[model samples]
Target chain A: MAETTAATKTVKFIISRQDTPESKPYTEEFEIPYRPNMNVISGLMEIQRNPLKADGTKTSPVCWDSNCLEEVCGACSMVINGKPRQACSALVDKLEQPIRLEPMRTFPVVRDLVINRERMFGALKKVKAWIPIDGTYDLGPGPRMAETKRQWAYELSKCMTCGVCLESCPNVNDRNSFIGPAAISQVRLFNAHPTGEMNKEERLEALMTDGGIEGCGNSQNCVRSCPKGIPLTTSIAAMNKDTTKHLFKKWLGM
Target chain B: MKGNSYFARKLHSLLGIIPLGGFIVVHGLANYQAFERGPEGFAKGVGLINGLPLLPLLEVVMIYLPLLFHGIYGLYVAYQSNSNTGRFKYGRNWAFTAQRITGVITFVFVFWHVYQTRLQVYMGKITHEELGSTMHHIASSPVFFALYVIGVLAAVFHFSNGLWAFLISWGITIGPKAQRVSSYICMGVFVIVSALFILSLVAFRGDEFNEVASAAIALLGNIG
Candidate 1:
């Protein structure tokens, strides 16, 4: 009954905008013709085609990042309606007006809706969230993982380095340097790999360092906010246990 | 101080549950004697503890030292935590913030409570028998009694909620469902323990203790 309401013919948007990396952010309102199945990205594209303010004034086109136009890439992440989520999957029909869009400030904001997720990348580097391989030496096929192990490993592998978990976490703010949950889960992912297990101790060691798993305040927000539904809290707990073991092992000189 | 911090954090969490949390539960049970029997029973419980061999050493090792570390390190951790609940309003988000807030409140309340009671005992200001009467004096005051109620509530809450967080960080509760159940269990623990301590506080306000305490107080010449 509400679908065909004349009031629903147009979608309203209040997008937070920053002209440059160092610029003060401001919110601008826009109105776009509503379509039956239009997602937030499609609404932004409509604004891009004809950039105009709701007051009928000419303005620059609102800029945002999106690829795969699906929820998978996570590059399209932004705070929509006060939550860190992918705009590509936030359908206009499902959102309340005026739809509020802001950049996730867990990392530095680049421009409009894009944030520089360099901290997440830096965390991934710190934890060594990768398997080592020498392509030039023509190594044989890597050790096979059991189907059972692979099933769970695939869940963690789905993490697209989205900053949603970090954005949702209060402990991951500027004052504390908590590595956040995404990278922690990635550590679990890489360590579970047969080849990646060779450096399990090293990964666990990295996790024990400053800004590691210990920095987690156990707010448990990361698990709920993850669009990929990666078991972020479980990884954090698993890693917490591993680091405790590694600490004792070092203490006993094992 | 700026090293891995893994051991330091783990040690803080462990110390909180160990000597500190254990001390709270035991203290609650001991105080319950006031409600169970009267001033005589409460005095006897304290006497039993004091009569233990190496009592001072046990107090130092099991209570003071661990509390010092947990309280001090917790303050440092609290200073570093910047909770933005206004932006991200979630249940656990508030709980994360509440844990830090209750920690500070509990520490302050505990410090004042100790300074008022234990430090006085050490300074020969209050004798062993007069301890119950001292509680009677404090709990008889509406202000002190209210503050005591708040202090006990904060202490019990911090301990019980800290238990929940400890289970997660230590990997005992691995999933959402497990964490949810643990929260309920911890709250259940909080309610039971808080009732015991509060009942003790209320019992202390009763005048039955002062007559027995006065006889003992008569022996301590020129005592406050």
Candidate 2:
């Protein structure tokens, strides 16, 4: 009788499903046997295994993405009960039921819970978010960074391009071309490097254009929603100052 | 498309604080004379401003142009924001949304205010000395009185919140702690400055202000 009671306990999920890239999205409820410590991804895996609605109707297996079930990969990001976050880190016990999952509408949904992050990657490319280093041959020992500078820079280096910041940001959406906070912070990271400083003006120039740094409305959602706890607002403020100085320098013919 | 809003956007921020925001501070303090010294004192403050050399040029260059750009560009900025604060519900997020909402309210209030006062004076409907009496008449109606209260509160909020954003955007307050502290300071500005405007509104509605102000206006007209 005790074993049956354990078996009967279940967790319910309401998943927003889009059958194809162009399909009309719908919500489907599923009940899975409750486990001691199941994350949203593990519950999703259970749904994939059974592919049955809570009403006992047969359905197609839910399609999603997950790699490195830890939070670092950022591949398992979705709207877990209205807040966009990494599903792998959103534990069943901690979340309010019935747990709801939806694809981040900031990006286009490719299939159920799977969004195309092309725009996010496109934004990174627009801002030159990485150092342009060729690793074909060995170079001399890199320019030394101050220990104090590296201490804070290390915090910013944790960004995994998870798209969480973009989803949470009010400035980044379909209507506008805001490069979003992630890419801007990455620009700050790369520019602080001794060699990366060479391209500093070019990067700042990129931010001075359309869909660039000017788009930020200071809603500051990116900092609060960042799973990596990166100081996104700090970077934005720094870049804002940098961009303003750059504009003045241009006017002065500097 | 690579758009360069860099300069225009920066100008909007700069103008908000410099001449436009500066004007709000002066305007609030000037109106406070109504509360502090009754009708006679309020007219004296208005006279001092009008007596300034190059007053028309100063008003046009420092106040009107900057106000036009900031108000119109602000409307565009507000419309561009597509995010809702309901889900996030963070303090900064709510402040962000409230800033945009108050901006629109303030614009309407400012236009209506200018039309009723400055425009009327320009049209010779009232003299500088009669300004106190005009305000009393306007403030006498319950409907207009309520509108003035909401409008004053909203405009004050917009100025205080915009000051906070101006500090961050210009890189003065970079850390979370610094930003948090400035938020408090700006709120202090909002409360104190709001009191000045509200007190002036109450003074405008009082019987003493109307009677004394009308007599003063008549005496001034005879001397002129």
Error of 2 at B114 (Å): 0.7
Interface RMS deviation of candidate 2 = 1.1
lDDT of 2 by residue, B1-224 (tens): 23467667778898999988888889989999999998778888999999999998998999889999999988988887874787899888998888989999999999999999998989997777778888898899889989999999998898899999999888788888998999999999999989999999998998987797768777877999
Tell me the deviation in Å of residue B12 in model 1. Answer: 0.9
Off by over 4 Å in 1: A1-8, B87-89, B219-224
Query: Backbone collision count in every prediction?
Result: 0, 1
Poorly placed runs, candidate 2 (over 4 Å): A1-3, A135-139, B1-3, B216-224
Task: Tell me what TM-score chain A of model 1 achieves.
Answer: 0.95
Report fnat in order of the candidates: 0.65, 0.74
lDDT of each: 0.89, 0.89
What lDDT tens digits, residue by residue, belong to model 1 across residues A85-140? 99999989899899999999878999999889888899999999999996778888
Q: For candidate 2, what is the DockQ?
A: 0.72
Clashing pairs in 2: A210-B3
